[model samples]
Target: MPVLETPPLVHETVVSDRREPFSDIVIIGLYAPKIAREARPGQFVMAVTPSGERVATALGIYEAAGDRISLMLVVVGPRTRELALLERGDRLVLAGPLGNGFQLQALGKNVALIAGGVGLASLLLPAQRLLADGARVHLYYGARTAGALVDAELFEAAGAGVSLATDDGSRGHHGYVTELLAREGRTHETIAACGPSPMLRAVGTLARTLGVRAQVSLEETFACGVGACWGCVVPLERSSAQAPAFPPVAPGETRDYVHARICKEGPVFWSDELRW
Candidate 1:
Protein backbone atom coordinates (compact mmCIF):
# COMPACT_ATOMS: atom_id res chain seq x y z
CA MET A 1 0.00 0.00 0.00
CA PRO A 2 1.11 3.54 -0.71
CA VAL A 3 1.66 6.03 2.07
CA LEU A 4 -1.37 8.22 2.39
CA GLU A 5 -0.72 11.93 2.35
CA THR A 6 -1.81 13.39 5.66
CA PRO A 7 -4.46 16.03 5.56
CA PRO A 8 -3.83 19.62 6.57
CA LEU A 9 -4.11 19.83 10.35
CA VAL A 10 -5.79 22.51 12.42
CA HIS A 11 -4.51 23.34 15.86
CA GLU A 12 -7.09 23.46 18.64
CA THR A 13 -5.13 24.96 21.53
CA VAL A 14 -2.09 24.98 23.75
CA VAL A 15 -3.31 22.49 26.34
CA SER A 16 -0.27 22.48 28.65
CA ASP A 17 2.43 25.01 29.44
CA ARG A 18 4.90 24.19 32.19
CA ARG A 19 8.65 24.32 32.55
CA GLU A 20 10.36 20.93 32.61
CA PRO A 21 14.00 19.77 32.72
CA PHE A 22 14.90 20.92 29.23
CA SER A 23 13.89 24.34 27.88
CA ASP A 24 10.90 26.62 28.64
CA ILE A 25 8.22 25.76 26.06
CA VAL A 26 5.22 23.42 26.17
CA ILE A 27 2.59 23.25 23.44
CA ILE A 28 0.06 20.62 22.34
CA GLY A 29 -1.71 20.14 19.04
CA LEU A 30 -5.27 19.16 18.13
CA TYR A 31 -5.11 17.83 14.61
CA ALA A 32 -7.45 16.25 12.07
CA PRO A 33 -8.19 12.54 12.07
CA LYS A 34 -6.18 11.93 8.94
CA ILE A 35 -3.04 13.44 10.36
CA ALA A 36 -3.40 12.08 13.88
CA ARG A 37 -3.65 8.43 12.88
CA GLU A 38 -1.19 8.25 10.00
CA ALA A 39 1.59 10.01 11.85
CA ARG A 40 4.61 7.85 12.56
CA PRO A 41 7.32 8.13 15.22
CA GLY A 42 9.98 10.07 13.31
CA GLN A 43 7.86 12.36 11.13
CA PHE A 44 7.38 16.11 11.77
CA VAL A 45 4.90 18.78 10.68
CA MET A 46 5.28 22.19 9.07
CA ALA A 47 3.12 24.76 10.84
CA VAL A 48 2.19 28.28 9.77
CA THR A 49 1.04 30.88 12.21
CA PRO A 50 -1.86 33.19 11.38
CA SER A 51 0.68 35.93 10.97
CA GLY A 52 2.22 33.94 8.09
CA GLU A 53 5.59 32.94 9.49
CA ARG A 54 6.36 29.51 8.06
CA VAL A 55 8.54 27.29 10.21
CA ALA A 56 9.07 23.58 10.54
CA THR A 57 8.45 22.16 14.00
CA ALA A 58 10.12 18.77 14.33
CA LEU A 59 8.28 16.81 17.03
CA GLY A 60 7.93 13.16 17.93
CA ILE A 61 4.60 11.37 18.27
CA TYR A 62 4.84 11.29 22.04
CA GLU A 63 1.11 10.77 22.54
CA ALA A 64 -2.02 10.39 20.49
CA ALA A 65 -5.73 9.90 21.10
CA GLY A 66 -8.58 9.84 18.60
CA ASP A 67 -8.18 12.87 16.34
CA ARG A 68 -5.88 14.64 18.77
CA ILE A 69 -2.07 14.43 18.73
CA SER A 70 0.41 15.93 21.17
CA LEU A 71 3.75 17.53 20.35
CA MET A 72 6.30 19.08 22.76
CA LEU A 73 8.37 21.98 21.49
CA VAL A 74 10.81 24.51 22.92
CA VAL A 75 10.29 28.15 21.92
CA VAL A 76 13.64 28.93 20.31
CA GLY A 77 13.13 30.95 17.11
CA PRO A 78 11.01 33.83 15.93
CA ARG A 79 8.40 31.36 14.70
CA THR A 80 8.59 29.16 17.78
CA ARG A 81 8.58 32.22 20.01
CA GLU A 82 5.43 33.38 18.29
CA LEU A 83 3.88 29.90 18.52
CA ALA A 84 4.47 29.48 22.23
CA LEU A 85 2.61 32.69 23.03
CA LEU A 86 -0.77 31.53 21.77
CA GLU A 87 -3.54 31.17 24.34
CA ARG A 88 -6.22 28.50 24.67
CA GLY A 89 -8.84 28.12 21.87
CA ASP A 90 -6.49 29.58 19.32
CA ARG A 91 -6.61 28.35 15.71
CA LEU A 92 -3.41 27.61 13.81
CA VAL A 93 -2.80 25.92 10.44
CA LEU A 94 -0.42 23.00 10.15
CA ALA A 95 0.74 20.43 7.59
CA GLY A 96 2.11 17.12 8.73
CA PRO A 97 3.06 14.54 10.30
CA LEU A 98 5.56 14.27 7.48
CA GLY A 99 8.94 12.62 7.04
CA ASN A 100 10.04 8.98 7.37
CA GLY A 101 10.05 7.66 10.91
CA PHE A 102 12.08 5.18 12.95
CA GLN A 103 12.04 1.71 11.49
CA LEU A 104 10.55 -0.83 13.93
CA GLN A 105 12.23 -3.98 12.64
CA ALA A 106 15.80 -2.85 13.30
CA LEU A 107 14.63 -2.18 16.86
CA GLY A 108 14.47 -5.92 17.59
CA LYS A 109 18.16 -5.98 18.45
CA ASN A 110 19.50 -5.07 21.89
CA VAL A 111 18.69 -1.36 22.05
CA ALA A 112 20.11 1.75 23.66
CA LEU A 113 18.46 5.16 23.56
CA ILE A 114 20.36 8.42 24.04
CA ALA A 115 18.91 11.86 24.21
CA GLY A 116 19.82 15.38 25.40
CA GLY A 117 17.57 18.23 26.42
CA VAL A 118 14.39 18.46 24.30
CA GLY A 119 15.86 15.91 21.94
CA LEU A 120 14.41 13.36 24.27
CA ALA A 121 10.97 14.27 22.96
CA SER A 122 11.80 12.65 19.67
CA LEU A 123 12.77 9.42 21.30
CA LEU A 124 10.19 9.07 24.06
CA LEU A 125 7.36 7.47 22.15
CA PRO A 126 9.70 5.41 20.08
CA ALA A 127 11.06 4.12 23.36
CA GLN A 128 7.58 3.33 24.56
CA ARG A 129 6.73 1.55 21.34
CA LEU A 130 9.94 -0.41 21.59
CA LEU A 131 9.35 -1.43 25.19
CA ALA A 132 5.77 -2.48 24.48
CA ASP A 133 7.25 -5.02 22.10
CA GLY A 134 9.40 -6.51 24.88
CA ALA A 135 12.73 -4.96 24.06
CA ARG A 136 15.33 -4.31 26.77
CA VAL A 137 16.12 -0.61 26.58
CA HIS A 138 18.95 1.42 28.06
CA LEU A 139 18.47 5.18 28.02
CA TYR A 140 21.12 7.90 28.58
CA TYR A 141 20.86 11.68 28.50
CA GLY A 142 22.12 15.09 29.71
CA ALA A 143 20.86 18.45 30.90
CA ARG A 144 22.36 21.69 32.17
CA THR A 145 21.27 21.05 35.74
CA ALA A 146 18.86 18.80 37.58
CA GLY A 147 16.09 21.24 36.69
CA ALA A 148 16.89 20.95 32.99
CA LEU A 149 16.09 17.25 32.53
CA VAL A 150 12.69 16.54 30.94
CA ASP A 151 10.47 13.45 31.02
CA ALA A 152 12.72 11.07 32.96
CA GLU A 153 9.77 9.91 35.01
CA LEU A 154 7.88 8.79 31.92
CA PHE A 155 10.68 6.52 30.78
CA GLU A 156 11.44 5.30 34.28
CA ALA A 157 7.78 4.51 34.82
CA ALA A 158 7.95 2.34 31.72
CA GLY A 159 10.68 0.23 33.34
CA ALA A 160 13.45 1.34 31.04
CA GLY A 161 16.98 1.52 32.44
CA VAL A 162 17.57 5.25 32.64
CA SER A 163 20.71 7.32 33.43
CA LEU A 164 21.47 11.02 33.41
CA ALA A 165 24.26 13.63 33.24
CA THR A 166 24.22 17.28 34.11
CA ASP A 167 26.59 20.04 33.12
CA ASP A 168 26.56 21.73 36.53
CA GLY A 169 27.09 18.44 38.38
CA SER A 170 23.65 18.49 39.93
CA ARG A 171 22.58 15.13 38.47
CA GLY A 172 23.60 11.52 37.92
CA HIS A 173 27.03 12.20 36.39
CA HIS A 174 28.90 15.44 35.93
CA GLY A 175 29.32 15.48 32.18
CA TYR A 176 27.40 14.85 28.95
CA VAL A 177 25.01 12.07 27.96
CA THR A 178 27.61 10.85 25.52
CA GLU A 179 29.99 10.39 28.41
CA LEU A 180 27.35 8.43 30.23
CA LEU A 181 26.82 6.28 27.15
CA ALA A 182 30.58 5.79 26.88
CA ARG A 183 30.77 4.60 30.47
CA GLU A 184 27.70 2.36 30.50
CA GLY A 185 26.61 1.74 26.90
CA ARG A 186 28.81 -1.24 26.22
CA THR A 187 27.12 -4.62 25.51
CA HIS A 188 24.13 -2.99 23.80
CA GLU A 189 23.03 -4.89 20.69
CA THR A 190 22.24 -1.64 18.79
CA ILE A 191 21.87 2.08 19.39
CA ALA A 192 19.37 4.83 18.52
CA ALA A 193 19.60 8.49 19.46
CA CYS A 194 18.27 12.00 19.00
CA GLY A 195 19.74 15.15 20.47
CA PRO A 196 21.80 18.19 19.67
CA SER A 197 23.77 17.78 16.43
CA PRO A 198 27.03 17.33 18.27
CA MET A 199 25.55 14.61 20.47
CA LEU A 200 24.10 12.76 17.49
CA ARG A 201 27.47 13.02 15.80
CA ALA A 202 29.10 11.54 18.85
CA VAL A 203 26.57 8.70 18.98
CA GLY A 204 27.20 7.99 15.32
CA THR A 205 30.95 7.98 15.84
CA LEU A 206 30.75 5.74 18.88
CA ALA A 207 28.33 3.31 17.24
CA ARG A 208 30.59 3.00 14.22
CA THR A 209 33.66 2.48 16.37
CA LEU A 210 31.92 -0.25 18.30
CA GLY A 211 30.48 -1.85 15.17
CA VAL A 212 26.94 -1.56 16.51
CA ARG A 213 23.91 -0.87 14.38
CA ALA A 214 22.74 2.70 14.92
CA GLN A 215 20.10 5.10 13.66
CA VAL A 216 19.68 8.82 14.29
CA SER A 217 16.95 11.39 13.85
CA LEU A 218 18.29 14.76 12.74
CA GLU A 219 16.69 18.18 13.18
CA GLU A 220 17.14 20.77 10.45
CA THR A 221 15.49 23.90 9.15
CA PHE A 222 12.83 22.67 6.71
CA ALA A 223 10.70 24.53 4.19
CA CYS A 224 8.47 21.85 2.68
CA GLY A 225 8.45 18.73 4.78
CA VAL A 226 7.74 17.10 1.41
CA GLY A 227 10.65 16.37 -0.91
CA ALA A 228 9.69 19.06 -3.45
CA CYS A 229 11.36 21.74 -1.39
CA TRP A 230 15.07 21.16 -1.37
CA GLY A 231 15.59 23.58 1.48
CA CYS A 232 15.64 20.82 4.10
CA VAL A 233 17.91 18.39 2.28
CA VAL A 234 20.98 16.94 4.00
CA PRO A 235 23.55 14.49 2.67
CA LEU A 236 23.23 10.72 3.41
CA GLU A 237 24.22 7.33 1.97
CA ARG A 238 23.18 3.64 1.70
CA SER A 239 24.82 0.26 1.20
CA SER A 240 23.82 0.00 -2.47
CA ALA A 241 25.29 -3.37 -3.31
CA GLN A 242 23.12 -5.31 -0.89
CA ALA A 243 20.53 -2.85 0.48
CA PRO A 244 16.80 -2.73 0.05
CA ALA A 245 15.62 0.07 -2.21
CA PHE A 246 13.42 3.00 -1.20
CA PRO A 247 11.16 3.52 -4.16
CA PRO A 248 11.10 6.90 -6.04
CA VAL A 249 14.70 7.75 -5.20
CA ALA A 250 17.57 5.51 -6.18
CA PRO A 251 18.42 2.97 -3.46
CA GLY A 252 21.70 4.65 -2.38
CA GLU A 253 24.17 7.25 -3.40
CA THR A 254 27.86 7.92 -2.82
CA ARG A 255 28.57 8.05 0.90
CA ASP A 256 30.10 11.47 0.38
CA TYR A 257 26.73 13.14 -0.28
CA VAL A 258 22.98 12.58 -0.84
CA HIS A 259 20.09 14.98 -0.32
CA ALA A 260 18.16 13.93 2.77
CA ARG A 261 14.78 15.46 3.44
CA ILE A 262 14.10 15.97 7.12
CA CYS A 263 10.38 16.44 6.37
CA LYS A 264 9.82 13.48 4.10
CA GLU A 265 12.58 10.88 4.23
CA GLY A 266 13.70 11.52 7.79
CA PRO A 267 14.06 12.72 11.23
CA VAL A 268 15.44 9.15 11.61
CA PHE A 269 18.13 7.50 9.50
CA TRP A 270 21.23 5.39 9.81
CA SER A 271 23.85 7.63 11.47
CA ASP A 272 26.66 6.42 9.26
CA GLU A 273 24.67 7.33 6.12
CA LEU A 274 24.50 11.02 6.94
CA ARG A 275 27.00 13.45 5.40
CA TRP A 276 27.58 15.49 8.47
Candidate 2:
Protein backbone atom coordinates (compact mmCIF):
# COMPACT_ATOMS: atom_id res chain seq x y z
CA MET A 1 0.00 0.00 0.00
CA PRO A 2 1.10 3.57 -0.60
CA VAL A 3 2.14 5.66 2.35
CA LEU A 4 -0.58 7.87 3.78
CA GLU A 5 0.30 11.45 4.57
CA THR A 6 -0.59 12.42 8.10
CA PRO A 7 -2.70 15.55 7.92
CA PRO A 8 -1.82 18.64 9.96
CA LEU A 9 -3.54 18.05 13.27
CA VAL A 10 -5.84 20.80 14.52
CA HIS A 11 -9.09 21.53 16.34
CA GLU A 12 -12.11 21.89 14.09
CA THR A 13 -15.61 23.09 14.90
CA VAL A 14 -18.76 20.96 14.95
CA VAL A 15 -21.06 21.75 12.03
CA SER A 16 -23.73 19.09 12.37
CA ASP A 17 -25.14 16.66 14.92
CA ARG A 18 -27.99 14.13 14.90
CA ARG A 19 -29.43 11.68 17.41
CA GLU A 20 -30.09 8.05 16.43
CA PRO A 21 -33.20 6.25 17.58
CA PHE A 22 -31.05 3.90 19.67
CA SER A 23 -31.42 6.53 22.45
CA ASP A 24 -27.78 6.31 23.58
CA ILE A 25 -26.02 7.03 20.31
CA VAL A 26 -25.50 10.22 18.33
CA ILE A 27 -23.69 11.22 15.16
CA ILE A 28 -21.61 14.41 15.25
CA GLY A 29 -20.19 16.04 12.15
CA LEU A 30 -17.25 18.46 12.14
CA TYR A 31 -16.18 21.04 9.62
CA ALA A 32 -12.58 19.92 9.23
CA PRO A 33 -11.71 20.24 5.60
CA LYS A 34 -8.06 19.35 6.08
CA ILE A 35 -8.67 16.26 8.15
CA ALA A 36 -11.49 15.22 5.85
CA ARG A 37 -9.31 15.39 2.77
CA GLU A 38 -6.38 13.52 4.28
CA ALA A 39 -8.06 10.96 6.52
CA ARG A 40 -8.19 7.38 5.16
CA PRO A 41 -10.44 4.54 6.15
CA GLY A 42 -9.96 3.44 9.80
CA GLN A 43 -8.54 6.78 11.00
CA PHE A 44 -10.07 8.47 14.08
CA VAL A 45 -10.25 11.83 15.84
CA MET A 46 -10.30 13.15 19.37
CA ALA A 47 -13.02 15.66 20.14
CA VAL A 48 -13.67 17.60 23.30
CA THR A 49 -17.16 17.29 24.67
CA PRO A 50 -19.45 20.23 24.00
CA SER A 51 -19.22 21.19 27.70
CA GLY A 52 -15.42 20.80 27.69
CA GLU A 53 -15.73 19.46 31.24
CA ARG A 54 -14.02 16.18 30.44
CA VAL A 55 -10.99 15.23 28.42
CA ALA A 56 -11.19 14.78 24.67
CA THR A 57 -12.89 11.54 23.61
CA ALA A 58 -11.66 9.36 20.76
CA LEU A 59 -14.17 8.50 18.02
CA GLY A 60 -13.87 6.81 14.65
CA ILE A 61 -14.08 9.00 11.56
CA TYR A 62 -17.40 7.82 10.14
CA GLU A 63 -17.72 9.95 7.02
CA ALA A 64 -15.67 12.61 5.30
CA ALA A 65 -17.20 14.67 2.54
CA GLY A 66 -16.11 18.08 1.35
CA ASP A 67 -15.35 20.01 4.57
CA ARG A 68 -17.31 17.74 6.88
CA ILE A 69 -16.17 14.81 9.05
CA SER A 70 -18.86 12.83 10.79
CA LEU A 71 -18.51 10.53 13.85
CA MET A 72 -20.98 7.96 15.17
CA LEU A 73 -20.76 7.22 18.89
CA VAL A 74 -22.81 5.72 21.69
CA VAL A 75 -23.19 8.02 24.67
CA VAL A 76 -21.91 5.94 27.54
CA GLY A 77 -20.42 8.53 29.88
CA PRO A 78 -20.19 12.16 30.84
CA ARG A 79 -17.94 13.02 27.93
CA THR A 80 -20.04 11.36 25.21
CA ARG A 81 -23.29 12.46 26.84
CA GLU A 82 -22.16 16.05 26.59
CA LEU A 83 -21.20 15.50 22.96
CA ALA A 84 -24.53 13.84 22.24
CA LEU A 85 -26.41 16.93 23.43
CA LEU A 86 -24.72 19.20 20.91
CA GLU A 87 -26.63 20.69 17.96
CA ARG A 88 -25.63 21.78 14.44
CA GLY A 89 -24.09 25.10 15.48
CA ASP A 90 -22.22 23.76 18.53
CA ARG A 91 -18.53 24.50 18.77
CA LEU A 92 -16.10 21.64 19.49
CA VAL A 93 -12.39 21.06 19.14
CA LEU A 94 -11.02 18.01 17.26
CA ALA A 95 -7.51 16.54 16.93
CA GLY A 96 -6.59 14.00 14.23
CA PRO A 97 -6.82 12.09 11.51
CA LEU A 98 -4.67 9.99 13.85
CA GLY A 99 -3.30 6.44 13.84
CA ASN A 100 -2.48 4.09 10.96
CA GLY A 101 -5.73 3.17 9.27
CA PHE A 102 -6.55 0.06 7.24
CA GLN A 103 -4.22 -1.02 4.48
CA LEU A 104 -6.85 -0.90 1.77
CA GLN A 105 -4.71 -1.15 -1.35
CA ALA A 106 -3.15 -4.43 -0.27
CA LEU A 107 -6.46 -6.03 0.68
CA GLY A 108 -7.25 -7.16 -2.89
CA LYS A 109 -10.71 -7.19 -4.50
CA ASN A 110 -12.51 -9.77 -2.35
CA VAL A 111 -12.86 -8.51 1.19
CA ALA A 112 -14.97 -9.08 4.27
CA LEU A 113 -15.50 -6.28 6.76
CA ILE A 114 -16.74 -7.23 10.20
CA ALA A 115 -18.22 -4.99 12.86
CA GLY A 116 -19.91 -5.43 16.22
CA GLY A 117 -22.00 -2.98 18.21
CA VAL A 118 -20.39 0.46 18.06
CA GLY A 119 -17.49 -1.12 16.20
CA LEU A 120 -19.42 -0.26 13.04
CA ALA A 121 -18.02 3.25 13.37
CA SER A 122 -14.67 2.25 11.85
CA LEU A 123 -15.76 0.22 8.79
CA LEU A 124 -17.89 2.52 6.59
CA LEU A 125 -15.04 4.41 5.00
CA PRO A 126 -13.18 1.21 4.21
CA ALA A 127 -16.25 -0.36 2.64
CA GLN A 128 -16.96 2.74 0.61
CA ARG A 129 -13.38 2.96 -0.56
CA LEU A 130 -13.29 -0.72 -1.46
CA LEU A 131 -16.50 -0.44 -3.48
CA ALA A 132 -15.14 2.59 -5.29
CA ASP A 133 -12.11 0.49 -6.22
CA GLY A 134 -14.46 -2.07 -7.78
CA ALA A 135 -13.93 -4.57 -4.99
CA ARG A 136 -16.59 -6.96 -3.73
CA VAL A 137 -17.19 -5.99 -0.10
CA HIS A 138 -19.23 -7.96 2.37
CA LEU A 139 -20.19 -6.36 5.63
CA TYR A 140 -20.90 -8.78 8.48
CA TYR A 141 -22.39 -6.67 11.25
CA GLY A 142 -23.78 -7.70 14.61
CA ALA A 143 -25.39 -6.02 17.58
CA ARG A 144 -27.08 -6.98 20.81
CA THR A 145 -30.43 -6.50 19.13
CA ALA A 146 -31.94 -5.27 15.87
CA GLY A 147 -32.13 -1.67 17.07
CA ALA A 148 -28.40 -1.63 17.66
CA LEU A 149 -27.64 -2.40 14.02
CA VAL A 150 -27.57 1.30 13.19
CA ASP A 151 -26.55 1.64 9.54
CA ALA A 152 -26.92 -1.56 7.53
CA GLU A 153 -28.74 0.29 4.80
CA LEU A 154 -25.94 2.79 4.53
CA PHE A 155 -23.55 0.03 3.55
CA GLU A 156 -26.08 -1.64 1.29
CA ALA A 157 -26.74 1.65 -0.43
CA ALA A 158 -23.01 2.14 -0.82
CA GLY A 159 -22.76 -1.07 -2.90
CA ALA A 160 -21.69 -3.58 -0.27
CA GLY A 161 -23.34 -6.94 0.31
CA VAL A 162 -24.70 -6.68 3.86
CA SER A 163 -25.10 -9.54 6.32
CA LEU A 164 -26.55 -9.12 9.77
CA ALA A 165 -26.35 -10.93 13.09
CA THR A 166 -27.76 -10.07 16.48
CA ASP A 167 -27.18 -11.83 19.77
CA ASP A 168 -30.92 -12.25 20.37
CA GLY A 169 -31.77 -13.42 16.82
CA SER A 170 -33.70 -10.20 16.31
CA ARG A 171 -31.75 -9.78 13.06
CA GLY A 172 -30.18 -12.13 10.51
CA HIS A 173 -28.23 -14.69 12.50
CA HIS A 174 -28.91 -15.96 15.99
CA GLY A 175 -25.41 -15.83 17.50
CA TYR A 176 -22.08 -14.08 16.97
CA VAL A 177 -21.33 -12.54 13.61
CA THR A 178 -18.07 -14.41 13.42
CA GLU A 179 -20.10 -17.59 13.37
CA LEU A 180 -22.09 -16.11 10.56
CA LEU A 181 -18.90 -15.51 8.62
CA ALA A 182 -17.69 -19.00 9.42
CA ARG A 183 -20.92 -20.59 8.31
CA GLU A 184 -20.90 -18.79 4.99
CA GLY A 185 -17.53 -20.46 4.27
CA ARG A 186 -16.87 -17.91 1.57
CA THR A 187 -13.28 -17.14 0.75
CA HIS A 188 -12.17 -13.53 1.07
CA GLU A 189 -8.85 -12.05 0.10
CA THR A 190 -8.81 -10.17 3.40
CA ILE A 191 -10.86 -9.70 6.54
CA ALA A 192 -10.95 -6.41 8.44
CA ALA A 193 -12.70 -6.05 11.76
CA CYS A 194 -13.28 -3.70 14.71
CA GLY A 195 -15.16 -4.56 17.87
CA PRO A 196 -14.82 -5.59 21.51
CA SER A 197 -11.72 -7.61 22.38
CA PRO A 198 -13.61 -10.87 22.61
CA MET A 199 -15.18 -10.34 19.21
CA LEU A 200 -11.80 -9.49 17.69
CA ARG A 201 -10.27 -12.58 19.24
CA ALA A 202 -12.96 -14.68 17.63
CA VAL A 203 -12.46 -13.05 14.25
CA GLY A 204 -8.71 -13.51 14.52
CA THR A 205 -9.19 -17.20 15.16
CA LEU A 206 -11.61 -17.45 12.25
CA ALA A 207 -9.21 -15.73 9.87
CA ARG A 208 -6.46 -18.11 10.87
CA THR A 209 -8.68 -21.11 10.34
CA LEU A 210 -9.57 -19.85 6.86
CA GLY A 211 -5.95 -19.03 6.04
CA VAL A 212 -6.88 -15.44 5.26
CA ARG A 213 -5.18 -12.24 6.42
CA ALA A 214 -7.07 -9.97 8.78
CA GLN A 215 -6.63 -6.48 10.18
CA VAL A 216 -8.37 -5.57 13.42
CA SER A 217 -8.82 -2.28 15.22
CA LEU A 218 -8.31 -2.43 18.97
CA GLU A 219 -10.52 -0.18 21.05
CA GLU A 220 -9.36 1.33 24.33
CA THR A 221 -10.04 4.32 26.51
CA PHE A 222 -7.60 6.88 25.16
CA ALA A 223 -6.51 9.50 27.69
CA CYS A 224 -4.56 11.34 25.04
CA GLY A 225 -5.26 10.91 21.35
CA VAL A 226 -1.54 11.18 20.73
CA GLY A 227 1.09 8.60 21.76
CA ALA A 228 2.70 10.71 24.49
CA CYS A 229 0.47 9.38 27.27
CA TRP A 230 1.39 5.71 26.61
CA GLY A 231 -1.77 4.67 28.45
CA CYS A 232 -3.43 2.71 25.65
CA VAL A 233 -0.51 0.43 24.93
CA VAL A 234 -0.90 -3.05 23.43
CA PRO A 235 1.76 -5.69 23.01
CA LEU A 236 2.84 -6.68 19.51
CA GLU A 237 4.93 -9.72 18.57
CA ARG A 238 7.07 -7.65 16.24
CA SER A 239 7.68 -3.99 15.52
CA SER A 240 4.92 -2.26 13.55
CA ALA A 241 5.07 0.57 11.01
CA GLN A 242 4.43 3.13 13.75
CA ALA A 243 6.20 1.32 16.60
CA PRO A 244 8.95 3.14 18.46
CA ALA A 245 12.59 2.57 17.53
CA PHE A 246 14.26 2.99 20.85
CA PRO A 247 17.35 2.01 22.83
CA PRO A 248 18.73 -1.34 21.71
CA VAL A 249 18.02 -4.19 24.07
CA ALA A 250 20.85 -5.39 26.28
CA PRO A 251 22.15 -8.93 25.82
CA GLY A 252 19.89 -10.26 28.59
CA GLU A 253 16.88 -8.11 27.94
CA THR A 254 13.77 -9.80 26.52
CA ARG A 255 12.73 -8.54 23.06
CA ASP A 256 9.82 -10.80 22.41
CA TYR A 257 7.33 -7.96 22.63
CA VAL A 258 7.08 -4.23 22.05
CA HIS A 259 4.36 -2.19 23.66
CA ALA A 260 2.68 -0.23 20.87
CA ARG A 261 0.48 2.78 21.45
CA ILE A 262 -3.00 2.06 20.17
CA CYS A 263 -3.86 5.73 19.73
CA LYS A 264 -0.84 6.48 17.60
CA GLU A 265 0.77 3.29 16.36
CA GLY A 266 -2.68 1.92 15.69
CA PRO A 267 -6.26 1.53 16.40
CA VAL A 268 -5.63 -1.05 13.65
CA PHE A 269 -3.07 -3.87 13.38
CA TRP A 270 -2.68 -7.15 11.54
CA SER A 271 -4.64 -9.83 13.31
CA ASP A 272 -1.79 -12.30 12.96
CA GLU A 273 0.90 -9.92 14.27
CA LEU A 274 -0.90 -9.09 17.51
CA ARG A 275 0.39 -10.80 20.66
CA TRP A 276 -2.85 -10.35 22.57
Best lDDT goes to which candidate?
Answer: 2
Q: Score residue 122 of candidate 2 by CA lDDT.
A: 95
Per-residue CA lDDT of model 1 for 21-60, tens digit only, reads 3456464655455666777766666667657756545456
Global lDDT of model 2? 0.87
Model 1 error, position 83 (Å): 1.5
Error of 2 at 251 (Å): 7.0
Local distance difference test, per candidate?
A: 0.70, 0.87
lDDT measured at residue 31 in model 1 versus the true structure, 0 to 100 = 47
Displacement of the residue 155 alpha carbon in candidate 1, Å: 1.2
Model 2 lDDT-worst window of ten: 1-10
TM-score of 1: 0.83
Provide C-alpha RMSD values for all models, in order: 4.2, 3.4
* TM-score against native, each model: 0.83, 0.92
Candidate that would win on TM-score:
2
